[model samples]
Structure formats: C-alpha cells, structure tokens
Target: MNILFLTLAKISTLKERGIYHDLMREFSSHNHNVYIVSPIERREGQKTTEKKEGNATFLNVKTLNIQKTNFIEKGISTLTIEKLFLNAIKKYFSKVKFDLVIYSTPPITFTGVIKYIKQRDNAKSYLLLKDIFPQNAVDMQMLSKKGVLYKYFRNKEKELYNISDKIGCMSEANVKFVLNHNSYISKDKVEINPNSIDLQLVTDVSEENKKKIREKYQIPYNRKVFIYGGNLGRPQGIDFLIETLQAKSGDKDVFFVIVGSGTEYDKLKNWFDSFKPENALLFPAIPKSDYDLLVQSCDIGLIFLHKDFLIPNYPSRLLSYLEFKMPVLAATDSNTDIGTDIVKNNCGMAVHSDDIKSMINAIDTLKKMDGAKFEVLRQNSLNFLKKEFQVEQSYFKIIEA
Candidate 1:
C-alpha cells in the first residue's frame, strides 16, 4: 500500500528519527510506499526542495516569511501554510493513487486536507494524535474559553475527529477523553498508539560510550545524575522545576542536568542562575549520538508535566530513558496516566506535581535505592517495552487496523 503522511515538521535527513519518521520507516521496510509532506517554520536557505530516503520521499513546502506579532498572527500563519501546502500536494499528485492518508494533529485545522484525500482517492484516513488542541490550550490558559479563537479551533478539532477512519491516541486517558466528547466516535475507533523510540538505535548505545559521555559532560562518575531533555515549555510547568532546584539547593552530590530549548528556557535559566544548585547543569540541545550517550551515563531520568494538563501526553522521552536502563522519576499527577504505567511496571517513582516535599522525598528515595534494585527496575521497564512498545508491534497493529 502507498501511504501519504502529513505533519508540520522540518526534515533535512532521515537519521534524526522521531515518532512519525520511525513509523513511516517501519511501513516502508515492510514493502509499503510512504511519502511525507512536512511543512517548516524556515528554510535556512537549503538548496533542495524535496528529497528521497530509501523507500520514503519527503515533500518540503516553501512558505511565506512572517514574524508572529500575537496569537492571532501565529494562528493565521499556521493555517495559511496548511492550506497552501495541502492544496499544492493534491495538485501535484492528482494522478497518483494514494491507498491511505494519515495525518497527525496539533494544528487540528489541517484535517481539511484529509477530507479532500478521502474524497479524491477513497483513501482510509488515520488521525495519529499526540496532543488534543484547544482544550489543552484552554487548560494552560493560553486562550480564553469564551473567545472566538477558542470556538473556531474547537470546531476545527471536531471536524478533524469526524474525518478519521481510525484515531490513534497517545494515551488511554486521551482515548477516553475523545470517546466522552464525541458521540460520533466509537470506543473502538479510539485506541492507544503511544509515542515510541527506534528501539534498535535506542538500545545500540554502548557502556564504554556512556563512560566517555559522563567524562565529556563533566558529570562526576561517583554521583547520581538525573537528566531531562526535550522541549522545555508551558506544558512542562518549568517554574515548578525551579521550585525543585530551589528545594535541592543544599544537596551536595546529586546532579540535575537539563538539555533542550523552548519558550521556558530563559525562565528556567534565570531561576537556575539565581539558585546555582551546585549540582544542576544547563545546556542546549546536543547531537543525537551525544544525547544518547548522556542518557546511558545517567542514573535516573526526569519527566515533568503541568499539574493542570489532565490531558494525557506520554512523553516520547520516557522510552529513551527505559532503553538506556535508567529508571524514571516521573513528576506528574494521577491524571497523567504516566504514573499508572510506572507503578504497574515497577519502573520508577511518581511524585505529585505541585508537592515540593513529595518531589524532594522521591528524589531522596531514588538517591538511596540499592544499585542492584535499580538494575532490577530498569530491567522490568526494558521487558515491558520489548513486549509492547517495540516498533515491529506498532507496524503490525497499525497495518492490520
């Protein structure tokens, strides 16, 4: 089968495999033809507009240059690219028969193109959702519930939901949330298809490399290192992370290293500067090989989510931690569903999001865990992942569905 997948992400080379790219590669390796239409925020003056990687092809759209002045301007620019890119793809591929069209939503507005694909090729459509929109925005107070923008985005979200032949939610709570909100969507249509890492690559980092990484990052070989890497933004509730840093200011040996960029980077940096918890280190994003090496060097991983975001987002970063045989210290609430998984698998401790005392307690307990017990916990997580989160299982299930 030939599938057309749509996402608003920049792709230069295929080596930096994330969720969408991993899934597409899975399908392609199984002798399926997969093409992607990825929109970007900038070009960086690249010479090539499109490229191919093995069985998969990438379509890079040239979009308008616009500086966002406000929320309205940002929304308009996002939708404009969606309209132009989707239309341009349809026009270019008029003669090609696409068996299925899979579109993931964050912008929810792009489902308009899914409707068009279904009509044009009679293709089955899948909504692989990572985040549920306007509601998440509203929960974050990023937009007012009564605003015209809220209603517009909400209506678009519903339209997107209604268009999918199958809906792949990132977590069980998100699946349940969809079923409760839409009478048209059956429980069977909404199912768990959580984010995953390329297990092969994730498992390939060597112990020797890990030691080298530890030395490179200036992480003391004798101390416990807790690492968090990914987008640091609103949903992460980084202010509370600063609270964790402040609470741990006197601790001597434990190291907390944060690596990534987002809107909250400056805020987190400012707080880090003021506290300078002798142990905490801050750095921007590093190369994948270097990042993987650091993950292996760490003793524990950190996962954070806003307490109010009842919407479930199983961070893809968790799988990488599990792959490295490092236990997670998930700082989130009960509503996150992540805590449920951690407890079920005996992988790590889950602390209440707003409770600084609880977080400190978790940190202390994690610090004191016996080395052999830590290995046991890490093994349990690896077994769980191999049994369920492997990319091969995802390939079979998605294809069969």
Candidate 2:
C-alpha cells in the first residue's frame, strides 16, 4: 500500500519523534510505502525539497509561515497551502497511486487537495482529526462567529469532513462533538484514533544524574517539581498559568518549571520579570532529548488549557508526561475529557482551569501523596499509555480502514 500523509507540521525527517512521524514509521516498517507532504515555512528559509529513506518519501513544500506567526501571515499561508501542496504533489508524485490519503487538522484547507487525489487515484481519505478549527478560534475570541472569515473556514471544515472517507478522532468527546455539531456526518464514519507515539524504552535517570540535572537547571532537589513542557500559547491559557504561579509563590515544598515558546512567551516572561516568583522557573523551548531528561527528573507533569475553549483539546503533551511515567495534573476546560480520563484511570488529578482553589488543592494533594500511592499513579500512567496511545494502534486503525 502506498500512503500519502498531508500535515501542516514541519517534518524534515522520520528520524524525529512526533505523532505523525511515529505513525508513518509504523507504516514504513509494515512494508507500506509512506509519502509525506509537510511545510517548510518561510521563516525556516528553506526551498522546497524531497528526500527518501527506506520506504518513506518526504516532499517538503515551501510556504508562508503557517505557525507561530502574526495572524495575517498565518491566514495567508493557510489559504494558499492547498494550491501549493497540490502543485507539488502533481510534480513530485505524479506516477504514484496512493492507496490511502491520511491528513490531520489545523488548516482544514485540504479539501481541494484530497478531492484531487481521490479523483486521480481513487484513494481512500482518512482524517486524523487533531485540532478543531474556527470554533476553537471563536472560543479563544480570536474569531467572530458572525464574521465572514468564520463562515469561510466553517465551510472549509465541512468540505474537508465531507471529503474524508473516515474520521479518526482523538477521543470519545471529539467524536461526540463532531456528531452533535455537524448533523450531516454519519456516526459510523467517526471513531477514536488518538495522538500516539512510537513507544521507546526509557532508562531510569540515576539519582546522581538527576541531581546533576537539577543543579544544572538550578532546580531544587528537596521540593516536588511540576513541569509543563509544550507550546506556550493562547490555547494553553497562559494568563491562568501566571495566576497559578502567583498563587504558588509562597509555597516552599513545590517548584514549577514552565518550558516552551509561543505568542504568549513574552506575556509570561513579562510577569516572571516583574514578580520573580521564587517557586517557579521559566525556560524557552529546549531540545527534545534535553526536555525528555528534564521531564524524567520531575515528579509531576502539568497541563493547562484556556477556560474559554468549548473544544475538547486533548494536548499531546499528556503523552510525554505518561511516557516518562510521571503523574499528571491537568487544569483544563470542562469540555475536554482529558481531565476526566486522568482521574478515572487513577493516573493523576484534574481541575477546571478557572478554579485556582481546586488547582492548589490538587497540587497539594500530589505533593503530599504517600510513596506507595504515588508509585501506583506512576505505574498507572505508563499502563494507560501502553493501553491507549501506542503508535501501532494508530497504524492498524488507519490501515484497516
């Protein structure tokens, strides 16, 4: 089978670890030809290129900056990407007949591209629904529900859905949301296919190495460390994150580590500069290998989402926390089932993003949890990851379709 994957994510190589990379690697390992088309954003200063390794072929198309840019550029990039991708696919993969076309959300502008391929090769289209779009923009108050932009994207969203032969949602809530909101989508077409990674054996950090890592980062060894490592953006509810840090300023037994960069980094940096909270440390995005070590050294993982989101955003960052066997503490909007799943599986605690009192209580609860019980949570985190988020599950789901 020849599989064509379309994404907005920058995929320079399959050597890197990510949800898409892991899934494509799974296909390649299974003796299927996997072709990926991803962006080389303007900010990257790279021309269009293609590379092949093993059974995987990568075609990176050049486009305007699609991520972490001003609204105007991001919008222009999103609007023009389909045409660019279609042209590239025609020029580079003209002879390949794709058996499956798997794409993810964020742009939802792939209807034209998918339509072209489906007609050209009679390929089956599969949507790996990761991000819900214009509605999420509205939830963040970035888009007006009554505006023309909203209507245009909303139409694009429907067209993308209508073109998809099957839709793989990240959670049950996602499936339900799509069915409830879009009456036209048949229930049989949607199922839960979540953000998964190619599982790797993680060696336990030695106590001495842990100490060295803590000393290197100026992290306290005695206190419980709670790390949040991912995009620092509006969708993450950065303001609430600041409020939580301020609330924990006086705590002596807990330390907070916030890492990652986005539009909201400057806002977080400004607050950190002004207040200089003793219990918290902030760093810009670090290398993935270093970040993984940092997560392994931490006692707990933290997830934050904006209170306004009606969309159930199950952040892939949760998978990282689980990968390192760290217990999770998620403060998210009520709509997402991520918090519910964490508590239900006995992996950790969850609270609404707006409730500072609950957040503090949950943190305190984890901070003081007994060793035996904490070990149970750690084990549970790994068990849940193996059960729900292995890349093989995602591979079989798409292949069986």
Candidate 3:
C-alpha cells in the first residue's frame, strides 16, 4: 500500500519525533510506501525539495509562512496551500497511485487536493482531525462569526469534512462535537483516534542527573517543579496562566517553569519582568533533547487552554508528559475532555481555566502529596499513554479505514 500524508507541520525528516512522523514511520515499517507532503515556509528560505528516507518519501513544498506569522500572510498562505501542494504532488508523485490519503486539520483548505487524489487514484481519504478550525478562531475572537472570512473558511471546513471517508477525532468529545454541530456528517464516519506517538523506552533519569538539571536551570531542589512546555499563544489562555503564577508567588514548596514561544510570549515576559516571581522561572523555547531532559526532571506537567474555546482541544503535549511518567495538571476550557480524562484515570488533577482558586488548590494538593501516592499518579500517566496513545493504535485505525 502506498500511503500519502498531508500536513501543515514541517517534517524535514522521519528521524524527528512527532505524531505524524511516528505514524508515517509505522506505515513504513509495515512495508507500506509512505509519502509525506509538508510545508517549507518562505521564512525558512527553502525551495521545494524532495528526499527519500527508507520506504518514506518526503516532499516539502515552499509556501508563504503558514505558522507563527502575521494574520494577513497566514491567511494568504492558507488559501494558497492547496494549489501549491497539488502542483507539487503532480510534479513529484505523478506516477504513484496512493492507496490512502491521510490529512490533518488547521488550514481546512485541502478539499481540492483530496478531491484530486480521490479522483486520480481512487484513494480513500481519512481526516486526522486535530483541530476544529474557523470556529476556534471565533472562540479566540480572532475571527468574526458574521464576517466573510469566517464564512469562507467554514465552507472550506464543510467541504473537507464532506470529502473525507473517515474522520479520526482526538476524543469522544471531538466526535460528539462534530456530529452535533454538523448535522450532515454521518455518525458512522467519525471515531476516536487521538494524538498518538511511536512509544520509545525512556530510561528514568538518575537522582544525581536530576539534581544536575535542577542546578543547571537554577531550579530549587527542595521544591516540586511544575513545567508547562508548549505553545504560549492565545489558545493556551496565557493571561490565566499569569494570574495563576501571580497567585502562587508566595508559595515556597512549589516552583513553576514555563517554556515555549508564541504570540503571547511577550505578554508573559512582561509579567515575569515586572513581578520577578520568586517561585517561578520563565524560559523561551529550548532544543527538544534539552526540553525532554527538563521534563524528566520535573515533578508535574501543566496544560492550559483558553476559557473561551468551545472546541474540544486535546493538546499533544499531554502525550509528552505521559511518556515521561509525569503527573498532569490541566487548566482547560469546559468543552475539552482532556481534563476529565486526566482526573478519571487518576493520573493527575484538572480545573477550569478561569478557576484560579481551583487551580491553586490543585497545585497545592499535588505539592503536598506523599511519595507513594505521587508515584502511583506518575505510573498511571504512563499506563494511560500506552493504552490510548501508542503509534500502533493510530496506524491500525488509519489502515483499517
């Protein structure tokens, strides 16, 4: 089988670890020919290029900056990406007949590209629905529900959904949301297929190594460390995170580490500069290997989502926390089931993003937890990951489609 994957994520190589990379590698390892088409944003100063690594072929198409760019350019890039990708597929993979076409959401502009593949090779289309788009923009107040831009993307979203043979949502809430909102989509077509990764055996960091990491980062060894490592954008509800930090400023037994960069980094930076909170430390995005070590050294993992979101957003960062056997503390909108899942599995605690009192209390609870119980929560994190988020599960789901 020749599997074609289309994503907005920049995948320069299969050597890197990510949801898509792991899934594609699974296909490649199963003796399927996997072809991945991803972007090489103009900001990267790279041209369209193709590379073959084992059974997988990577075709990186050049386009306007699609991620972390200003609104105008981002919009233009989204609108034009389908055409760019279509042209690249025709030029580079003209002779290949794809058995399956798997794509994920964000731009919601892949209807044309998918339509072409379905017609050209009679390929089955599977949507790895990672995001609920224009509506999420409306939730963030970035897009007006009554505006033309919203209507256009909404139409695109419908087209993409309509064309997909199957839609793999991140959670039950996601499947329910799609069915409830889009009356036209059949229930049989949607299922829970989450953000999964190729599981790797992680060696527990030695106590001495953990101490070395804490010393290197200037983190206190006596205090429990709570780390949030991912996009610090509007969707993450950065303001609420700041409020939580301010509320915990006087705490002596717990330390907060916020890492990652995005549009909201400056806002967080400003607050950190002004308050100089003694209990917290702020760092911009670091290299992945270093970040992995940092996460391993932490006692707890933190997740935050904007209070306004109506979409059920399940961040992939939760998988990272689980992979490292760190208990989670998610502050999210009511719509997402991530918080619910965490608590139900006894992996950690969850609270609404707007509930500063609850968030603070949850933090305190974790901080005061005894060693044996804390270790149980950590083990639960890994257990949940293995059960729900392994790459083989995602591979079988797509292949069975």
Any runs in candidate 1 off by more than 4 Å, and if so which?
Answer: 43-48, 64-73, 201-209
Ranking by TM-score: 2, 3, 1
lDDT: worst 10-residue window of model 1: 64-73
Q: What ranking of all candidate models by lDDT puts the best one first?
A: 3, 2, 1
For model 3, the stretches where C-alpha displacement exceeds 4 angstroms are none
Question: Residue by residue across 124-238, what tens digits does model 2's lDDT show?
Answer: 9999999999999999888998999999999999999999989999999999999999999999899999999998997778989999999999999999999999999999999
lDDT of each: 0.78, 0.94, 0.95
Q: In model 2, what is the error at residue 398, expressed in angstroms?
A: 0.8
43-149, model 1: which lDDT tens digit per residue? 35543266778877788776543222245555776568678777768756667688888877666877778877888889888888887888888878888889998
Question: Which parts of model 2 are misplaced by more than 4 Å?
Answer: none
